[model samples]
Target: MIDLSFPLREKVALVTGGGSGIGRATARMFAQRGAVVAVAGLDEAPLLQVAEEIVAAGGQALPIVMDVTSEDAIASGIACLADRFGKLDILHSNAAQTGEMQEDGLIAAMDADFWDRTFSINLRGSMLCAKHAIPLLLASGGGSIIFTGSGKGLAGDLDYPAYGTTKAALLGLSRYIATQYGKQGVRSNVVVVGLAMTEALDRNMPEAAQKLMTEHNLVDHLGRPEDIAEVVAFLASDQSRYITGAAIVADGGFTSHSAVYADMLRFAAMDTGAKA
Candidate 1:
């Protein structure tokens, strides 16, 4: 008989950007499912808060202050996890450069430094984390590596070219990791996320912009951090054992319809009114 309950029991997981938003939600969910979580992030305060919350909830957690942009920092963080937990069963590389769409715009006008910086944090950071953590995963007899991706990576937009490019690169990187290590029992995947109601999004996006996004979504409401967290938790668990090298789109059907979907709907409504 297959055991379905407590799917992540006894697992040791690490989540980058685990201080807040989807990362924090996922860390909490992992702990709830019986995994000991290590929450890593640039800020010690939020990480500690999250760790303490998990502990308060009767789960084990460790807060590690890690700047994903630095290879040394990433390596050191993983080492610390190994030292404390002795093994790693899951790695959720969820950190990325965010909340700077204006600066990440139009390729022709983009600052070279900004472009490089975005890649450093969004793309290179994941690469470094994987590079350091893969050996530990292998030592533990294989594990899951999940990258937090974006819908922008799948489809082009008029804004945030740098952000989109880096995210798209992650899809390729995920595939490469999956191909290279699948036989060794390691699985790599990307969760291509939609706009969620994270603290940053709520603060940064205008009400009109939020409404426009909601209008395009198939669901009546926009996503929440907990929604994406559920997807990440599923990918991290053994329940998804047969899945690998895949980009699972969890965007509330944001990119599923045609570009003219909304316009078509409006036209249909007009035609119906005219007939009536």
Candidate 2:
């Protein structure tokens, strides 16, 4: 039998936006797998809660309140974790902002400040994290860098253009890191997340929109934060030791079907007297 267990025993992981949603799920999952985790976010209360939960569960965790856009803060957070864990093995740059998840229309409607602020958190922040974390990763005999991307990065969208651009940039950055550090045992990959039903999505998206998405999804459901966390865990572990410079889609087949597939399914359902 092939061993499919993803074991990260003794690994040290640092996750941005770990206070909630996908970041929180991934941080907790990493700790559950035996990795000493540092959960970083702008909110200290939620970060502390996550850390306490991990400790209560018999896992090591540190809550770091740091702003990703600040180089000094990123450096301090990385140093704090490194000092405590002795080394850094996994860096999950999961922090992102979608300009309040508003539909910031086409290029004509986008402002310079909007684009800059989006990139500041989505792209540049990831850069700073990698920049400071790489030295520690290298010192720890190489590790993994997991970036969270989105399907919009690959597909064109009429809204949130800035967010899409930043996500695409992350894909490129991940490839660059993989090429530059693969020889040193460091691996880098991007997790292209789909329409996950995170708390933010629940609060922002209407029920009808979510239902329409579910209808289009090949798996017949929206992704959960834990779904993405599972893949992040895989990429962070030795199971994916040979995988790098890759965009692993965790979208529950959302992008796997053709545009007409939903129609086709509807037609079949109608012929079979099933709900379309």
Candidate 3:
């Protein structure tokens, strides 16, 4: 019941890890909707490339080089953006690192260094961004902050404890932000990404694990970055004005096992008065 077109005009957005993958797609989408986008990433090449594309499309964009794990870099980057844009409206924290592979066991066997690095980028990075971006967003009369998540949050994938833990934590973080700042006119939400075809997919997966990805989805094909982007744009816009403290699963129905779940629930509750 809202006008979705150009809902983000005059808004300024920042997409971290915007060099590639879901972050890049989301930055493009925001620019397409007439928002001034700041593309941030540790790698300047991909970040600049995305910004250039947005500019070529007759959209406004600025490329920023930042290391999310470094609080000083994050603070300086936000300062630069604030100086240029005057205010911040949307912050999409999407940067992350894929932890070390598991050879013979679950994540418990995974390297401790990998776990530490994973959390630093995935969890601490988001917190750092939120810390630096909050003031300007508040000055902009409140805005939306969108976290990039994964289906791993809903269910732990074998051998990926680091990734699963971080994604699941992201949901809780977003919820707290939403709960605490709802009255300030700020919104916080997450896009629970399905298996998307990004570089991260091919590099980290083997033949068998990759096959499992396709079977996991209800849709015929695997999820794409754009699929997640569409949802991100919606949450970043006025269209989702009433949505906050929520995690929208955009996984091509990967989690839509309602019938199977219902039967399981009935079985569980059968012993008691309630159905499982």
Candidate 4:
């Protein structure tokens, strides 16, 4: 019989930016799959809330207030997990700074601080998490390190230069980690995130932009935090044991097609007289 369940029984996971959005979803899913989770982030309240929710559901979890950009904070948070769980089987790096949507302008017009801030959080933060978590994961005999990426990282965008640049850097970082430690049973991969209707997006994303995204997406609607969370859980589990140093696009096919997809659909509708 084929075992369809992806069980993470007795595994321990640490998730950065676990307060909300993709991080929170991932943490919850890990718990559901039998993993003990440490939800770490800059905010204490949200982390506490997540931990309470997991425990209330009869799962193991701990809230750790952490700032990923700080090496000391990352180390401390990992140490906390070690003291509590003894070893780590997964590290999900999901924190990111969008940078100044206004200040992360063209190369000539971009602000130095904006670039630095974005890199500090998205790039350096991910590095710190891996650096600190690998030893613990190694102690566990093997584990997964899943870093979050974005479509902006894979493609060029006119805006958010810093955000895109930092995200692109994460893909390279994953490959390096996978190459250096794959023989030792450590796996690293990048999960390229798509447009999701999170609280932040609902407040910030324009209605027109959402409609345009839906038109281009292979699926009828945009992605969700849960969508990215499931992919992260798979990579973290033994189900993806052989998958390493890969960029898995869980974007509902947002980046799978050409920019002219909508235009082609329009033409097809005109010729065939069929609604697309």
Worst 10 residues of 1 by lDDT: 1-10
Report the error of model 2 at residue 28, Å.
0.6
lDDT of 3 by residue, 132-155 (tens): 887787888899999999877788
Displacement of residue 29 (Cα, Å) in model 4 is 0.5
Residue-level lDDT tens digits of model 1 in 204-226: 78999998888889999999989
What would the TM-scores of all predictions be?
0.97, 0.94, 0.87, 0.94
Candidates in order have lDDT scores of: 0.93, 0.91, 0.86, 0.91
Q: What clash pairs does model 4 have?
A: none
CA lDDT of 190 in candidate 4? 97
Candidate 3 Cα RMSD after full superposition onto the native fold (Å): 6.1
Comparing 2 and 3 on TM-score, the stronger one: 2
19 in model 2: Cα distance from truth in Å?
0.6
Q: What is the C-alpha RMSD of each candidate to the true structure, in Å?
A: 1.2, 2.4, 6.1, 2.2
- Clashing pairs for predicted structure model 2, backbone only: none
Q: Candidate 1, 170: how far from true, in Å?
A: 0.5
Residue 30 CA displacement from its true place in model 3, Å: 0.7
The residue pairs that clash in candidate 3, if any, are 265-276, 266-276, 267-276, 268-276, 269-276
